[model samples]
Target: MNFNRKQYTEDDLLALYRGILLPRLIEERMLILLRQGRITKWFSGIGQEAISVGATLALNPDEYILPLHRNLGVFTGRNIPLDRLFAQFQGKTTGFTKGRDRSFHFGSKEHHIVGMISHLGPQLAVADGIALADLLDRKQKATLVFSGDGGASEGDFHEALNVAAVWGLPVIFMIENNGYGLSTPNSEQFKFASFIDKGPAYGIDTLQIDGNNVLEVYDTVRQAAASIRQNPRPILIEAMTFRMRGHEEASGTKYVPQELFEKWVKKDPVENFEKYLLDEMVLTSRSQVAIREELKSLIEEGLDKAFAVPMPEPNVAEELADMYRPFAPALITPTSPNTTEKRFVDAISDGLRQSLEHYPELVIMGQDIAEYGGVFKVTEGFVEQFGKQRIRNTPLCESAIVGIGLGMSVKEKKSVIEMQFADFVTSAFNQVVNNLAKSHYRWGQNADVVIRMPTGAGTAAGPFHSQSNEAWFFHTPGLKIVYPSSPYDAKGLLNAAIADPNPVLYFEHKLLYRSVASQIPDEYYTLEIGKAKLVTEGDDISIITYGMGVHWATRLLQTMPEVSADILDLRTLLPWDQEAVAQTVKKTGRVLILHEDTLTGGIGAEISAWISENCFNYLDGPVIRVASLDTAVPFSPPLEQQFLPVQRLQEKVAQLLKY
Candidate 1:
């Protein structure tokens, strides 16, 4: 094969040859370990190492690369220790993730690599966010993200491309078209002649090349990197290759035809690259044989060392807990006392303003968040003040945008993402529940992002717009859920959520935006997350509620002179104040859990269950729950009112008092 000597020297070609040889040798060793029951699984990149090595070498050392399971050559090209890779496969404590994750799901901050989850498509959006940070910092760095042909069929793939195109981010979306997505062939995946053909529709440059040829892949990526650094636009490259093995070591190649397997074997990237190096006189036959022997010895040594490493202790869970400990309250210089009264919407806006002024790395993004200042106007004038660099307006891709926030958070940039409506959060549910909430536990990385959700009912916005969806996230651990009912709490908790080191679901009631008002301090302060407020002290009964339900309970309490109920506003739902609830329940000897969310599987049920378990003897009556009927919010006023009837709440309270 002809090569470009100017683009790559003999030394570079030899290194690329080593890159191809190392992964193949390591896979053979790992397969031995798998058979010996020392390792659980193996995802080999036997015939596709050329693409990973070439692409990694094409970018700057400091540039980021998010690799999928099959890109082991990228790790080798980055000079990550072979023993560390073996340690991860063995689930030893010396692994990249400290034995928290297995297989190829590990990354290094020092190497500028973000570890990937099994859901392959979300990383593209995350790469976009990394590029956004580089652009904001005015740096000349680009991010390379790898995904399989099967992952391209996911919605996140298209959403990521759309966002990258619209923002003109410096990202390279590299697709490893290895002919098959697990057991499914590429013929059934899509109808496009080539994956690169779709790049034009997304306004991105495209390229398709022989992935087995190291020189060709390297030259193409090097040129693409130069253009991207100057122009800052996304590029799509589809590298044609083949997976020599099945998806994993255990998954045999029975589905693969013998002819196709044999054909790929003939064009094996490692063997072909070695032959090219020998043909070009870059390496002699003797040197090539020595290199293969050296790689085999190195693999054996790495496996030996990794086998001696200790497994993670059971107390490693405690270490994980310590790593994910709640962030302490932020210290702030109060400019003024609580002398200024403000509405809920103004309070939220002021909180955002304070956050932007305090944390320079704090970024706010959502649909119409930049120029339009969001649909609810909570972020009005923010783009003008903070500029579009920090305050970004994103495409209407909830999953991609949330994924962007997740990526930025992992890179140490705190992000606040707004979902125009709480209901729309369902679109990004996987990113939230799977990626954001489980990031720390899965890979020991914190997703320090706050997702602002405008929620609740009363505007008759119907099922789509009005929803009390806190229950959905409340069930998910590794996420903080905060729903403040008053302006003071809103301003304070929003600041807390932004400063928090964990992912927070900040639920802002849309109905209370204009209706609720309170005196809040002009200066910045963060309310303690997971703590409830004692709105009133009463000896009769305790009413635990959040969001708009707080107002309903308070108003109903005024009408019932015979029932003096202690109103407790649970500002943060996920880690609810058990001590506060216990004290209130002990003092009153009765409790009523109320919420605007539906009756089934509501947070009220959890609170009631806790009270029954912990304060059963203190209770004067059985714990009662008053919530909306188990149905979607209706469009009609009367039906909606009937669904969440105040009269039914009154009757429930009366009945509880009688009990």
Candidate 2:
């Protein structure tokens, strides 16, 4: 059979063959190394090289491509140095992630490549954010995101597709259906006949093709890119292919039918493409053998260079230093020429409005936020004031929306993501904890986002709505948590969080929104995120609390004047005011930790342990803690009141004072 040429030249065709050949040769060599114990592990892309290579080549060099584990062609096509890639596989300091993360789990901003996380589906939504940024900037570029039959089952897949269609984003969703998802066949994965049908369901253009055909894959993607440039919208491509090896080097392929392997081996992409090129007179057998020898020598030289590089040193300082970008929370005094009284919700609105005015790259997104002003009316007139482009409403897809915010951050754009209620953030926990929180630590990428969490349990919103889940994120190493008590702190700390370069969870108590008012400055000001405020002064006891607990402590102290106590409002949770806690502990010799979260495994536990360890010598009595009962927040008002620690706090304060 002879080959027919269209837009691409003879040289372009030869380059594509070389692109497919490199990954196959490299993986074959790596498997030998794996047996020799030179490399740790490998996710072989031996068979599906055409999809990664053709799709990457289809887009402009500047456009972004999010590659899956098997897409070695994406790297080699971009001409990334083989030495650096081999070093990354070997977990050396010269790798993209500095050996922080292994395998093809790292991204390179210079190459416009966003690498995949273990959770494959979330990257689809993150691609939306990247495309959204381009749309907002009117850039003529599209994003190509890769997924598989197994990963397509994740909720993020549906959410990302629907959102991309609604927002008119330019993204190419590539699904490589390789028959098995780590031993589970596609037969058990989804009942649907084809992923192509999903495109019409979401109003996106769909294409289905044989993934092994290199020329066909290249032509189809090239046309899709051209269509998106003229009319920006998402396109879904389902490539039917098969992986010859196991999921990883260790997992054997006994689960796969031997007949299936024999059938696919005959239709091998590399061998078939070589045959077609020979028939078309694009190359002779002599040239093909010479090319293989040259590539093998190159791979050997690159492996030698990578092997000579040293491994990362094992030390606390190095580990800690790589965890976060260099950042120092601002500390501004509350002194201003003018001040005004405002409610907690109004203060937050003011801060957001002022931040939008201050930062050109800042955008706010959440459900019911654009026209409806969110569930709480916090952004009542934001859409009109800032326009729809900046203040946008999102579908009820928490995980994808947060992933979108992360994608925007990757392009140096700051985002304020509102989780309608703090409880709903659970749906997006993987994106927040694994992707947003760990992006900077794994690589030198900044996830400049401030997640607004409407929290607390005073309202009768029940178990689903009322949850003070700050403790859930407090344990995460790469995130900052801030829970403000009053309007003044709310406005200041929020601005501070938006300004900080790391991912921050800003918790706003639902009960304090309209009930509490304070005299705040008219102009914008920022307070230190790691700093604590001394609300009241005393000499006998110390009341350490935050959010609604601050108000509870104040009410108890006002009622009992005999108990002269110091009230310390911990405006920030993750980077809590340890210095203030220790100082107050030494001065009073009595400490009472208070919070609205449940008692077991709460933030109070960490504070109590810290006080016990650091201030053990300064203790006059046992460290006391008063927190809500360790159970789901009840729907009944009476039970909720009983479950809360308002009454229990009074008893604990009295006991500590007596001790």
Global lDDT for candidate 1? 0.87
Question: RMSD for each model, in Å, please?
Answer: 1.6, 1.4
Q: Can you give the TM-score per candidate against the true fold?
A: 0.97, 0.98
At residue 292, give the lDDT of candidate 2.
96
lDDT of each: 0.87, 0.91
Question: For each candidate, how many residue pairs have backbone atoms clashing (under 3 Å)?
Answer: 0, 0
Off by over 4 Å in 1: 316-326, 331-335
What TM value does model 2 have? 0.98
Worst 10 residues of 1 by lDDT: 322-331
Residue-level lDDT for 271 in candidate 2 = 87
